[model samples]
Target: MAIAAKHNLELKQYDVTNAFVHASLDREVYMRMPKGYQKPGTILRIKKALYGLRISPLLWQKDLTATLTQLGFQIVPHEPCCMIKDGIIIFYYVDDIILAYGKDQSKKAQEAMDQLKQRYSITGGDDLQWFLGIEVIRDRSKQLIHLSQVAYYEKINRLVDDQTIRHDTPMATSELMPREGLATPSEINRYQRKIGSLLYAAVNTRPDIAFATSRLARFLANPSQEHQQAADRVLLYLSDTKWLTLRLGGGTAMQVASDASFADNTLDRKSSQGY
Candidate 1:
């Protein structure tokens, strides 16, 4: 949706039929019959890509490229996973495909989708509300794409129900620093697992918790009471920012910055680093 809103392009989706079976095999293989064959020594020769093979997906992609090229679609020179024809562009990640074209050229784009459907399954073209866990909201007139993680935030809240906890800073100032021989082994392990989940969310859709999550993660091997307090603080913070969103700007670049503090550890007098 971001790409469509930014470039005024229409989107479509397609799925390949038995994608792995299209691969041509040079080697012969045989498998035992499944309980019904009369001859015990009988063997079946393999001619196509099979499940669990390491090269099936790559081979399927090659077959797809050849087929699309024969239909006059030029693969994108820089991106082997993308293709173009006239003004229409399609970007493919594995089997999921996203189509982009001018607003006036929607019919032609549908024609292209139909051709693809003749060989594959075209699942969608309109009202794509969600993709890859990011909620997509499209504003046609404003030409904007808004991606939110309200669902993710709700999941966090359910996991850590701290309704009475103060909606203050995620990590208290005291817990920001580390001390030697403070955290027990069991406590450290449990806290580390919780902080790891928060880190994943921070990286994907919750930048607000990055600082606190990183600070708590540092003490994973020896999490003290301070670390536990800090982890709870993040839960408190989430209580208030559950609906917070990172908007997709009209022309914004996805850039990130990290910083470290020298001698920020009050307990051990150690410097702090962040990414």
Candidate 2:
């Protein structure tokens, strides 16, 4: 959406400080005393949403949707996560929201955002930087929008001290055959941990790792030595291509093409080379 604007639109972001807390609870519930509260005989009477509760997210979303609707924003039928007003489009993922609109609607949206922020525990204005771990980079000149997770890679590298690892293609052309032996309990645990981290990286911003991550994740409990090596290859790939990012140019729409060969899975044994 930003790409299609071509610098004529401005992008703004805002965060709901305690989004769940803003949600009105419909059920009567009680909570233990908060740490600082001196209510020795009192408990928190449920009035608003709180994390870990089953109904928290739903309540927050309901309230948030209502608030946005009241502000003259029309919820897009095709996308409940999106709202539109005049030329402005707003997309929300829980508490984090992105507003995109031309110059005229920008100020009005900003005003509404300011009013909302004041009424609720929300953060707004131009200084908002990161949202949901996704780093936002705006090309004001070309009006291009790019989201990446290079910071996340750095964090993982620092944690594992794998910054110097080499990068390789995520997948191998070779096929695998399952073995009859069971995996050691400790080995299985370790494999699951490593694969979990890799999966997080792949889903966040590293599309290049998607294939490799998915392929290796299937053998988490009883992975062969070959699978372990393939997992390492993914780390190496990240190390070498640490700067690679998904770049979005000025385009009116997104077009994706995919080709799949039936029986692509090795279990089915049909020769397939697809992207």
Candidate 2: list runs displaced more than 4 Å.
1-8, 34-44, 158-167, 184-186, 253-256, 270-275
lDDT of each: 0.70, 0.72
lDDT of 2 by residue, 1-275 (tens): 43434554667777788889888899998989878786778777888888989999999888877887887888888888888877667788988888776676757877777766766787665633576787767676876656677777666553332334454576677766564688788767766776887888788678778777877877987976666666666766776677776665676667877766677776866644556
Residue-wise lDDT of candidate 1 within 169-204, one digit each (tens)?
666655355656767677866687678768766886
Q: Residue 120 of candidate 2: its Cα lDDT?
A: 77
Model 1, residue 116: displacement in angstroms? 2.5
* Candidate 1 CA-lDDT value: 0.70
Can you tell me which runs of candidate 1 are displaced by over 4 Å?
13-87, 161-168, 174-196, 217-236, 251-275
Clashing pairs in 1: 170-233, 263-271
**How much is 147 displaced in model 2, in angstroms?**
1.9
- Residue 205 local lDDT, model 1: 67
TM-score list, all predictions: 0.66, 0.82
* TM-score attained by model 1: 0.66
